[model samples]
Target: MTEGFLSSEEYDEQAHRLYDVGDYDGALEMLKEGLALYPNAVELCVGLGYARLAREEFAWARRAFERAMVLDPAHEDAMVGMGEALLRLGHRIEALRLFHRVEQMGFDDDIELMLTMGRALYRDGLYTQARDVFGRAVAARPDSAEAVASLGYALHRLGDDVGSGRQVRRALRIDPDLHEARIYLGHLLYDRGDWEGSLREFERVPPVEHWDALAVWRILELKRALWHMESGDARLAPWEDRLRALEELDDPIDRLLAEIESEVAEKDGLALDPSQLELFSGRAEGGREHRVRSPDGHVYRGSWSAIVRQMRDAAGFGHEPLSAFMRRMAERWHEQSGVDVPFRDPEVFLRAAVEYRLMFLEDGPD
Candidate 1:
């Protein structure tokens, strides 16, 4: 049908489809056209609010939401949209009040609204509140894998690893094909020193489905350690390529910030323990048997166990057991990256090692 003939609801539907597929600009244009024809269309205003929110135009989003609310004060979606925009604008208390108002208006059991509000809270680092919101969503729809897994992630961020694991596993049982939750469970298992469990969860996710660099890195480390796969092994080619592709997609600014943070971490670590200066010193130089290069270009060659041994040996701490050295390095990595790296297994140790730029695999004679 011609644009002039299209009803406001039809325009809203088209815009919703575009928004879902990440076509924010198209959604905005369509909503603007619909609003021009149907100036009093509350749904069109709400759609515009969400589309603007998707593009992170928080002020514009709030204006659209406010328009929708003024046109229809009881509109549930407009209230939630306004709350989301407020949260993004750093008006936490105001956002919470708006969300509370929506809940009190009988949207307390709205599964989608609850999930949206929970995600907004989680993104703003309010994990405890996010967990409660997600819990409400789960309660509203007990079998919702998305709600359960979201709750699990919120719990994980709040440091309740055990509860997180339980909730994630429950979500997996509800929907095994939820790859995001599966990947999260894999990391949780790896953190708890369950190599076989972690590998099982990760392997279930096809390599093409693996989008996160951290997950792909863990897969590579697990394969090398568990199966004794060589760096040049054909089986590792897909995952290695995936890792490379993901790294290439990383924001240059983010990469620079991470490098700077790593440098700052090393310096702070050195201040805490003068002996760690050796680990950071000559970062881009050194190597031997089974040579491999860290992300920062530091080289270390040998068995995975020997790699940690070599790091300490170079620092004159060779007398320390390999496990102890690995644990110490893992602790330092956690301090820097806030990721718990399990060191009980050599390959797992290298997973976090490679991630935090402590060490990584390179082609060399085994």
Candidate 2:
């Protein structure tokens, strides 16, 4: 060892502090330096992989975890991280192999491992499985607001709204500032027509990103609600500039739209739905068994969950054009009856969407 050099223990303390403060790049740098001295350190390797994962450099993350696995083949953390990397890279079968290998090792009893497993399942869009995993996480860590919130989000995604809503409210009661819970609760209230409660929860969200999703969508939806209730129109004036600020800060909606368009462009002239969606069960052209036939010969190819997600995608990206007709509708609604309109109402919005060509939304089947 170099004279007067800091020990690996000292380096790890510094790296841990950097990681805790949301400096994944700095953490990676620290880990690389630490590993230069302790080449075989499994902790440093796993930490390096996670830091890379935070930055979304999935290949680097996989390599780092792979190195850790080479150092200690049976390290649960290394195996889990490797699975997560492969999952994110769209190697689902390979990822599942690693995940199941860990499961077979009987590591499910570990609360921390369950949490990690739950997150991997959630990322893979296996909502039911994720819900079960997170439920186990909640059982193992009753006091953890995060675990409760995870189960709540998974349940909501799985369409168990009643159970999901109860868990989310419980999570909020336990910790008011939990933004993921706040976001999920806001969506639930919006869906149930509790505009006031929905707005309150959305307003409570700090104007930033958390849990891998930005808060911009909530703000856009809030603006949509205000637009629908013109008696609530006073709120809209301020939101215009607020929306502009967020638009300037990050154009996540446009980016998301571009991703969708790029997905189609990549399918070699076939106008397939975005990869995230699988709305169409079976197609005559594909010759897959007809699980359920589309009403028309042509069909959309995306998941039901993706369609629900497109609601937010529409509310976020389609707000400008939809606003023109939406405002007119709201005004007429108020003139005829004094009651203000609710924007997120599925029926009301669906009617308007039939006419609006908002990203896979239209009056006619595509």
Candidate 3:
């Protein structure tokens, strides 16, 4: 009975069962033998292609699936398999054409095909098109946070920053554990110079019990960098003990401090005045304006006025006369417009303000 000749149907059924059970090697062997007896069997070719795909032999899989498509052009599985193989081979346009063919054949239920097309569009930087495809995916499955996040990322790439922010926030509202959305939001805030807001957003991420430690370390490093920039201090002694407490961090804050120190050294070496180091020491009180030639041969005026204002405010000057002046200006602006201007950290605000005043003196306000 074991040696009995099996019919084509029996062989095909056995091949499919073997494939279903993840025995790709066994399935390939059986299909190879079966194909010899039925050389033109399209199903057998598809089975062989699937076995090749399971084994990650994408080129071989493409050849087998193309043969299956040639034998039976209307074979949906063969078309999808060929498209996937082409996509893996980086023939994105050809793969999208095949996917479009699949769609034209009334296979709208193919969520995997849609996702593949969307990803291809994303890689090509056709983000608006990608967003449309991802929108369809969301419509098909409203509860999919992955789809929502993908759409949000597409929108962000397309320069719809506000829309992207809203989409990511919506994803977070739907699923608070969506780490990607949280990180993207943090990045948007940081780019806008909302350092405190960005820090608050980043801190919402829980400890990395199962998440990637590198991501957490990067966020913490960014926070420390912002703090150093605002405080104009590099000693790190005050935060040294707290940094040690974060033993689980893969790359410690001390490493980040060392990198910052190296960067300061490189930049400081190019400075014209050594005494100007006092500006970064948090001791300077007045803004300094300078005309410097940019590396691109562009002559531009740069000012460090904001740094002076920050130093003045931080030097135990509680409600000083300058503070009142700034308050009056802020209040006057608020009275003219309903929107309140965002106040930077004392040091940063002062530095930027002083720099602006110097620029006004040299270039005049535009």
Candidate 4:
């Protein structure tokens, strides 16, 4: 029996050697044969789970990991494998729970586990929690630009724009080649209306041609959007030649548009109801009215911003168009109603009035 066990151990060692050499099929074959002789072999089960996971067979990988866990619940690799499989299956919450268990079981020191947990939380929209997890990971390995960038993303999601910017900058300082941090910092600056700053950030992004087509397209689209937004010129002439040069490449313009639309929808508290949208009016036989629905199920007819802009325009409101609107309003309101508009800054009052008027229009004389 001892000799048989030694033979099984030798077979397992050979299987691991095959796995190390990237001979996944041979490794799996050997592991299966070894496991057939020693069904409860924890190492064999873990190796099989890894092989299955590498092949993208997440369900089978999960089963093997589960069997390994049953044999040895303290197996860190098995636990991590199970978490990975669960993550791939979109069971993020379960994966997180398993990861947390791994952490509690003295796996908290593992940078990889922390990263996995942080990423899972980020994907689950728990940005604050993700940031905390990433912070721990960064503390463990301060030199990891990936961890710093991920933490920055989580902070950005949580609306800590300044904090996020700092984190991103720190990541770039650590590793100037960190393209994700550069891109994200650019996005954050763009969100805050710092067009020149955003352009500068984007300029630092590495030109990794053909490696990440979608990311490249996103960068291009962002530049175009920034140019158009800041200049208010829809002609796209400034970027036309460059864009044409990129047309032959994989253009992720549609994806970028979708992301922008979703972001706008979330910010405006409006439902991205496709049923309310009209496209290509110039080519259509007749002009069609697009209906938009809000998150509250209120049907809004027309483009969201256009409708709001028209309402504000009709109300004789001009925030972005006039530099003195806030100052003028504050003076007017102070003289008329004796109510201090509660804004110390001219821009703040201007934006507030625009928002107030928009709300008044929606609510109607209330």
- CA RMSD (A), model 3: 18.5
Ranking by lDDT: 1, 2, 4, 3
Comparing 3 and 4 on TM-score, the stronger one: 4
Between prediction 1 and prediction 4, the one with superior TM-score is 1
Q: TM-scores, in order shown?
A: 0.69, 0.61, 0.45, 0.50
lDDT of 3 by residue, 19-121 (tens): 9897988899888888888888998998888788777688999999999999999888788778767866668788778877877887654666666567656
Report the lDDT tens digits of candidate 4 across residue range 1-366: 223454567767988898889798888888888888889889999989988876668899999999999999988888878887887677877887887787788766688778867775664456777888899889888988889888888887787878888989999999998776776676577557777787677666545421222223334556667654443355434343333343333222323434655666568666555733432211132322333333233232223233332222222232222222333445556776665553333223333443544222232332
Count clashing residue pairs in model 2: 7
**Candidate 2, residues 1-366: lDDT per residue as tens digits?**
224787777777777889889798788888898899999888899989989887778899999999999999999999999988998788888877887788788886677787887877775666787888788778767777878888987887777889988898888888998876787777678768787788788778755432212234445555676655442466555554454453333333334444665666678868564642322221112422111112232122222222223333322222222323344345545576554553433233333333342223333343
lDDT of each: 0.77, 0.64, 0.60, 0.62
Top-scoring candidate (TM-score) = 1
By TM-score, highest first, what's the ranking? 1, 2, 4, 3
Error of 3 at 40 (Å): 9.7
Cα misplacement distance, residue 331 of candidate 4 (Å): 48
Q: Local error of candidate 4 at 161, Å? A: 2.3
